[model samples]
Target chain A: MPAETTRAANRERLAARRAAEAAARAQAERRRRTVLGGVVAAVAVLVALVAVIVVQTHRTSTSANAAVPANTVDGTVISVGSADAPVTVDLYEDFQCPNCKAFEDASGRTVAQLVADGTVQAHYHGMAFLDTSANGRYSTRALNAAAVVVATAGPGAFQAFHDLLFANQPVEGGSGLTDAQLVQYATQAGAAGSSVEHDIRNLTYGDWVKTATDQASKDGVTATPTVFVDGHKLADLSSAGLTSAVTAAAAG
Target chain B: MRWNAATAGPWLGTAARLVLGGVFVVAGALKVPDPGAAVRAVRAYRLLPESLVAPVAFGLPVIEIAVGLALLLGVFVRTASIAAAVLLVVFLVGVGSAWARGLRIDCGCFGNGGEVTAGETAYPLEVLRDAALVVVALLLARWPASRLALGGRSVAGTTDRKEYSRAR
Candidate 1:
C-alpha cells in the first residue's frame, strides 16, 4: 500500500466518527427539549384548573352575602333598652356556640335587670362563625330569625325573643332549631304574627349574619361569647366579673 | 442527563411518594366540603393577603387533589415531583412562620382547623413532616423511579426498571 493512500484512509475514518458523535448529541438535545415542553404543559394545565375553581368559589361565596340589605341601628342591627343609656354593653355571640348559651343562662338575668332599671343598654352582635358545625348553617339561620324580631317588633319584644332562643338552645354540633321552631319561639315571646314570622321562615337576614360574622372576625372577635364594654373586651365573663367591669366603665 | 446516584435509592423515593401522595389526597378531600372552615383556618394563619384568603382557601384543595392524583399515577412524574417539592417547601415556610409568630391556628391540612381557643399546636411536628416530604420530592425529581407508573418514562429516558434499581 502507498503511504499517501494509508494516510487518506485514516483521515476518512476520523471524519466518519465525528459525524456519528454529532448526530447522537443532536438526538439527545431533541429528547431534552421534548421533556421540557411536556413538563411545562402539565404545570400550566394544573394552574388553569386551579384558577377555574377559584373563580367559581369566589363568585358563589361573594354573591351569597351581597343581596341582603344592611339594616343598621334603625332597621339593620338590634339594640335593647334606651339608645341614650349611660352605659352600653356589647355582647358578641354565635347561636350554635355552647359557651354563648352558658353566658346567657348565667348573666342574662343580670343584664335584663340592668336594662329594666335603664342603667345599661345592650347591643347584641349576632355572628354565624359556627356555620361549619351544622350541615345547614343553623347559626346563620338563628341569627337571621333574631333579626326578624328586631325588625318587626320593638326592643322590648326582641329581648323576650332573645331569652327564648337561649332557653331552648340546641346541643352543640347538632343541627340547630328549624325555621318552624324559630318562628314558634318568636310567637311565644309575643314578637310574631307579623313580618317577624315571615322573615324567620324565609331567612331574610341570612346574608346579614354572614356579613356580621366577617365584620367581627376583621375586628378580632374570633371566639364566641365575647363581652365588651366601651369597646374593651372583659376577660372574665362571669356575672360578677361583668357587673364590676360595667360599674367601673360607668364610673369612668 | 445522567443517572442520579448521588442521592439514589428509587425504592425510598417510591415509598415516600406514595405516602406523601396519600397524605395530600386525604387533606384536600377533608377541606373540600367545608370551605367556610377552610377560610377561617387561612384567616387564623394571618399569613396571606386579605384578598388572597378566599381564593387560597378554595383553590388549594383542588390543586392538592390534582397533584396527588398525578403523583399516585406516576404520570408526568418529574413535573409532579417538582410541584410536590415546591408545595412542600411553601407549606413548611407557612407553618414555620405561624409557629414563629405564636399564632394559635390549626394547620387546616386535615380539616376542622380554625381559631382554636385552647389546644396543643403541633407546629413542630407539622414542620418536620413537611421537611421530610420535601426530601422525598427532591429524591423523585432526581430519580423518579417507582412501580406501576403510567408514563413509564421520567427525566426523559429513565423509568422504574433495572436501570433505576441499579442507579444506586
Candidate 2:
C-alpha cells in the first residue's frame, strides 16, 4: 500500500511540472508574437510618415519656386491706387469664399471711392485656401488668373478681374468657375495678351497664389475677406465700417 | 443556447473593429487630399509650434490610415486597438483644451476643421465622441478576439475573457 501511494505522488509531481512548462512555452510564444507585431507597426508608421514628409516637401518646394508676377508689391500683394496715398488697406480674400463675396459687395464701392480720391492705397492679397472646397481648385485657379492679369494687363485689368471674380463668385463646395468663363471674364475685364490665356489655363501664377496665402496666414489673416486698415484689423467688415476706418486712418 | 460573454463577445468586437476602422479611414482620407487645409486646421488649434504644424499635418493622416487598415483587416488587433485608443485620447484632449481656452475652433476630426464662428464650436459633442471612441478602443485592446479577424488569433486567445478562464 505504501509503494502504491508513493507511485501516485510521483505521477502528480510530473503532471504539475508538465503543466508549468506548457504555460511557460505559451507565454514565450505570446511575447514573441507581441514583439513581432510591435516591429511591424513601428516599421509601417515610420515608413508612412517618411513618405508623406517627402511628398509634402516636394509639393511645397515645387510651388515655392513658382514665379511671382512682376506687378505684385513685395512679391505677393497686388497694389491698386496711388502709391502716395495716405492710408494703406490690405485685403486678404479667397475667391471661393462667400464671405469674401459679401465683403466685396458691402465695401467694394467704398474702397473704389477711397482709391479714386487718393485717400487710400489698396493692396489685395488673394488667397486660395478654399481650393479644396471646389473641384479643380477654383480658388487657386481664379487667383492665378488674377495674378496673370496683373502681370500681363497691369493693375487696372487686375482690379476689374478681381471685381468680376467676386461678383460672379461660385457657390462654396462646388467648382467655382471654368477656365473658359475665367478667360471670358478676363476679356470683359480688359485683360489682353495670349499669356493671359496660357497662364490661366496652366495656372502660371499658382505659386504666387500659394505664397500669398501662406504669407497671409503668417500675417495673422485667419479668415477670408480680412481687412487691415493702416495695419489694424478692421473688426466690422461693413461699408460704413470700412469707410470710417479709412477716414480715421487718413486723418492720422 | 444562452448568450453570454463567451458566445457574444467576439461579434461585438467585430462590429467595433469595423466601425472604428471605417471612421479612421474616412477621416484620414478626407484630410489626406488637402494637406494644406489640414495644416491650417492644425494651426487653428494654436497648440503646436508653427514649424511642427506641417509635419503633424502631413504625418498624422498617414498614421491614421495605417492604423485603420490594420484594424479593418483584423491584423494585429491588440496593437491597432492600442494605437487607436491613444489617438482618440489625444483628440479628446485637443477638443477639451480648445474648449477650455475659449478658442472657437472645429475639432478637425474629419477634413474641414479650423476656426469657426463663435456660435459654431461643437466642443461638447466632439469631446464626448472622442471619449466614447477611446473607450471602445480600450475595450478592443482588452478583448482583441473578434470574429472574422485575420491575424489576431494568438493575440486574442491570450486576452479573450472566457478563453483565459478556460485556458486556466
For candidate 2, what is the DockQ? Answer: 0.38
Tell me how far the alpha carbon of residue B115 in candidate 2 is from the true structure, in angstroms, after superposition. Answer: 6.5
Candidate 2's residue-wise lDDT over B1-168, tens digit each? Answer: 367776577779889999888899988888877666677788777889998988998889888888898888887888889999999988888878878987656777898536342225788889888888888899999988777676665324334555533432
Best-fitting candidate, measured by TM-score?
Answer: 2
Model 1 error, position A172 (Å): 2.6
lDDT of 1: 0.73
Candidate 2: residue A109 Cα off by (Å): 1.3
Each candidate's clash count: 3, 0
Give the per-residue lDDT of model 2 (tens digit) for A73-157.
9888899999999999999888888888888998998999999999999999887866654367888899999988888878888
Deviation in Å, model 2, residue A241 alpha carbon: 1.8
The fnat scores of all predictions, in order, read: 0.15, 0.31
lDDT of 2 at A10: 100
Output the chain A TM-score of model 2.
0.94
